[model samples]
Target chain A: MDQERIQDNIDRYLSGEMNPDERREFELEVSQTPEIQRLLDFNRKLYKEIEVWGKQKLRKRLDDYYSAYLEESDLDHDQAAQTHIADPIPAVLNKTPRILGARWWRMGIAAGITGLLVISMIFFIRQQPKVELTEETPAETPVDSLEEIAPPDSLQGRSKSKPGKEGEQPKPQQSVPGASKEKMLKSQPAYALSNIKRLPKSFVRAADYPQQLQYTFKNGMLTLYGDPLIPPLRLKLFRQKGRLLLQFADDFFFIDPTETARPLIQIGPLSVSDPQPLDESIRIRLANLQESKFTQSDLEVWTGTSPQQIYSFEEKNGKRALILGGLPEGENPLVYVVNGQTCFLVLGSSVFELDNAVNQPVVLRRINGASSANARLFEGSKEFERKVYKIQ
Target chain B: MDDNHLIEELRNGNEDVIKYLYEHLPMVESWIQANNGSRQDALDLFQEAIIVFYRKVREGDYSHDSRISTYLMAICRFQWYTILKKKTKQQESFAQINLFSGQDTGNSSGEPKISQEELSLPSRESYLKNAIEELGEKCKAILEAAIFLNLKMEVIAQRFNFANAQSARQQKLQCLKRLRNKVSYEYVMSLD
Candidate 1:
């Protein structure tokens, strides 16, 4: 048979549309022809995969619809519980196959970044002491409840931010079977950051305190430069695994003794409330720079190592960088940025190796050409592991 | 409910059944964690496992010898293991160390190396999906109606204003053939 005929037969057989005689002949021919058999097998697998693809898309659409419905339901319930028992009614009603949005690729990227952020969150849990709501601060804000917050449609999400009973960890959501899609919509797991305070503490803008703070992470201690009038508040925090996290509040920048953008390089807008976070990276010191992720980005930088390759960040001119462990010793691998805004390399790690190589930035060969991949750091993607460092 | 009933609910696409599956995510969560898989890995894998499980049950003669939760966990374990196996070059040694160290001690290191052909399955599947998306809005509507909604030819023909079920069957056949061609082209390009 011709290639076209064979292809059609394969399709017919896989689709379960073949007539009895046609099916018998095709099966016999398939057994005899190795290539034809492989084709049949692959087409069959592809057929099943297409079904799965459709199902996956359906699930995503359902998830979006259910989540939006749940967000509406949770408006009145301020004392946020960890798991919302799904209302069975909503899920059934909302199964009318609707594509949530055309930007699934973006969601996939955002999901990956969210995974990284979750890892950062796990790391955050280890370093920061549990958040204690000040007695005057209205109510205690626990991270558990904060994670469950649905984004406010019209500031309704804030009501849920109010701290739960003193120290009770919101119990892990238990599945209540027989719940309607309506219930599931209300009880969807906390997938996205629903509000502003839900942002991690580490990622707020560092430029908030221009003169009042000078944070330099070097030699295992965070060097802070604070205002002379106030007692210098220095935390003995150091960079971990070549990453340094600095936490700053919006109110901190409010008191600008000397109003100038001279020393305080603005990485992003320092604010408690904004649907979109800032998108900026500042090279505070050549060796160390802070990349504040307040918003989403289309292109993301990724570094992959061979399975056996062991590398460490080495301090080249006070900036610790991911240098191959066995490479012949050299200067800091420089990633050049012409415009202060659109940069080639932002020090993903907060902890910088403080050095005297201030104005002179080392430029390196882009041997491993910077490749772009889709990874959106979702809304409120910045800030994890809230640690305040005084710039000494 | 009995195990059989649980499987039935899954097959029926019960929202409660799906939600129950998700609630049991923490069970596989630990296994993924210890094996260097992230929470996101656990999330994606669990969902896929549930869908696969549902389809398997939807097929005839699926026995309910064990608890649904146990069965779900087993499916998740296999899915994750296959994913990891296809991933790492040193997966030969890695699979030996199972997600958790205790079970399946015998025939551990004797795992076979995944073939290039099998390795290409996922990318091919992804390519096939993209190809389907490019099948145009009309094709999407017709094909989705037939395959996803499981509509009969007569109903689909009337819905799309076809003259008769015969014409609709012919159109559906053509669509299937086109999809096969698109998927095959994608597979070949993926190999390249």
Candidate 2:
């Protein structure tokens, strides 16, 4: 045969495009001709290698997905720990009654004493001259005036300083006590100094904010910095194949401090797109079998009508065995070997097991059960189709 | 997603299935670690079992009678058992050797020789891999699209910017021919 003819025949045979008669003839030709057989064997090996390559690609993808999962899980754990640390009141409340009673009595006595001192101080202050009170008011005046005049952007450059340092440069006065610090910072932009306490202990405030809020990470703890009004943008820290990455939104950015010009190099999205739709013919065939209710009588009728459908039936060692066939060519029964024993046979997308001890009827019921389950899968596809149609 | 939907996704080589499959890893890891295997061993073995499971699903052999996790665990256990047996045999063989003796095994150099696993691969597989690699990137892409992805000749043609389906088919055949020549030459050379 010419090379072209040989290639064509081999493609057809391997692709299962040839009918049984054609396949038999081709096999005969192959067996007789060593050259053709050798070529055919090579093609088969090539196809197998291609399959292995595809599986390796899948394994690589799985590794990535697993890494992403681990990162997210770690982030969750840290967040949970932070939440626990934020609220210690419940834990205190859960203490033993004897310890709680003593602590509560002590707190009550301290509060009474504090209330008496506050009343006496108020009376004494009221007795003071109006000029003296005015002199003290300037100390608090800088904070109120700064809060009114300072633009939100100016807050970024305000470094921590002593209370009386207002004369040097208009900075946020640290002298304010109680709610004054919170009130002052609240008027500022999203990355206020007060918000620093909200961050995890491992994250150090960035030395300079050239742009938006930034933090330098100490440990592997992820640093989240964004507008408090809106939801905080979570940047998951991921270590993949020895390279550090920060996942923000749908994209992953490489974390390399050395690359100061572009510290975060944009890596492509980590998520894999949904797989392509299954083969149309396979889908249609599966859909058609959605309502098939196979029973013992149905099996018997199928066997009687077409002997070829019954792949094989034999008696060995006084034990009868039956193997149902008549599936599409190249789609043989799927033998599921579990625990080193063939436990299940999935034929025609329906499952059945071979048991010599059980009668045919019992085996038939099991087949029926498995077939019904298989049908349900198709039913799910039908529901999906309906949803798609509705959307259209 | 349900098991059936997951199976369908797996058949299409979807990566999302990996996340769902990963949930079962901790179980396998704990089992392997308890059975005198390391976390790395568990990971490698789990990946292999998943590949086997994927092949089975593609071949239409996997039945929904059992859950995917149960099936995976069974495969892992079976594979781990096989590995343990091999390790035991290797240990027995090592036990037979007298390391305390002053005699040298072979070379004077203390450095360990590269094992077969460290090499490219088995001779036949390496030959095939090298042949495919020699086919060049474009040819590999064409072949992968045509054979692995099972794309139509027309689709392959458009994808590779060929003149038409006929040209694409011609290119594919040409690539295959080159691959075959390389593999055959290597086989002939090896035989000689």
Candidate 3:
């Protein structure tokens, strides 16, 4: 039999497309021929591998669902804690005031008798004469007087009540200077500072006076103004979550990369120049920013780096992720920004987006093509060698 | 979901079943930890148990005589015991023996008793896995679509933009040939 015929028979046999007669004939052929049997064995093994692949695909989906479940559970717990523990004073204060209905007449009689007794006692005390102050006398404060006047049973009840236990007295709100401001600062999401280093003096002069700088890219070249001491610094543009972020030195600015008239962004003291035309590379890269579907395995293969650890952390989307290691790193770690399902790859200053790159190595293979294009543009410049930041 | 519904979902390979399966992890974890296993060990053992359970369900070997939690716990206990027995070869501690004595361990059904060999992937399968990955994206997709997903050749051709079912079949065969060569090369290198 021809190899094609044998392959067809094997495919049909494995797919269960054969009848009993065809299956029996195929088994006889397999029993007589060693080569055909080996081929069948290889196809069977391949079939198993495909099954494994399917399982892995299923596992990936399960992992995603599990991550979302954990995130949701965590959020629910946090919200419950906030409602019950973080701020409870409002809950206590919102209770309806008790109405003293039937006991009002009896309470009026008791109050009239107490008022006559207090009037007689005050008259008696005035008649006794004033006491003299001495050096050793400790002044009786209002708090001390109130404590002395409090009923013994109420004092006992106060002593018995534990702090933070049910029915305990609400804590008095203490005023701490700048505490709210500090909390606000703490609550804000902090920029990742591990990969950012202090800008070298060569990049920007410390004495430059401008508070805001505007820069533009025209024909693949960056133009800056105001600071003659400043050399051409490498800039990285990437998308975090859904916003475009530009990073240079230790500072990053959120910008709308699509806007034709770039907004004046404030960076410390360096002023940047505006070019007559936008760079074609930046325009192309901005247009390419989109959602991608690269799997954990594809990331491992392309970057040639495995995660040092697998753990969960809350992402900006308010979902917890079991992220694999820090980020993509290597000579040319294609995708620099991976936020949820979106991925962006950096080639020099331009950022290109990759979509559904998993099981699609061709998208990643384009990195070589993009890199060569960058190589031709920047040739021998230090900008070509700058490490791409792996911003999570 | 009830056991019947869960079993039906698992048979359909619905990934939502994973969330349901995870509900059983804590039980399995506690059992493994009780048997001198660490949390990580419990996690690894439980994951293997889940895979075994999933495979059994897909293969229609799972018997509904026991609850899903009970079945999963049995698999975890059996796997952990096998691991401990291997680790401490000579000393069969009394606790380990007592742990399984009264337990069902899914032996009643005689279908879900997973051995260590069944839990772990064979070395050849690992080699085949690497070879499949090395087969580039398109070839990998074609093979998986045709064989694993049981997708029709016509559907595979349409999805992959092939000219026809015949072309898709040819492409799959070509990919299989490359994979065979790669696996053989890897086997030869391993021998050396």
Best candidate (score: DockQ): 3
- Per-residue alpha-carbon lDDT of candidate 3 for residues A264-354, written as tens digits (9 for 90 to 100): 3533322233322222223212111111111121111112112111111212111111121222222122332221222334322333333
Candidate 3's TM-score on the B chain: 0.59
| Full-model lDDT for every candidate | 0.38, 0.42, 0.41
Model 1 spans with C-alpha error above 4 angstroms: A1-8, A16-24, A30-52, A55-392, B1-17, B31-38, B57-65, B81-130, B136-138, B141-169, B177-192
What docking grade applies to model 1?
incorrect
When sorted by TM-score, best at the front, the candidate numbers are: 2, 3, 1
Higher-TM-score candidate of 2 and 3 = 2
Question: Among these predicted structures, which one has the highest lDDT?
Answer: 2
DockQ of each: 0.05, 0.08, 0.10
Error of 2 at A223 (Å): 56
Residue A49 displacement in candidate 2 (angstroms): 3.5
TM-score each candidate. Answer: 0.32, 0.39, 0.33
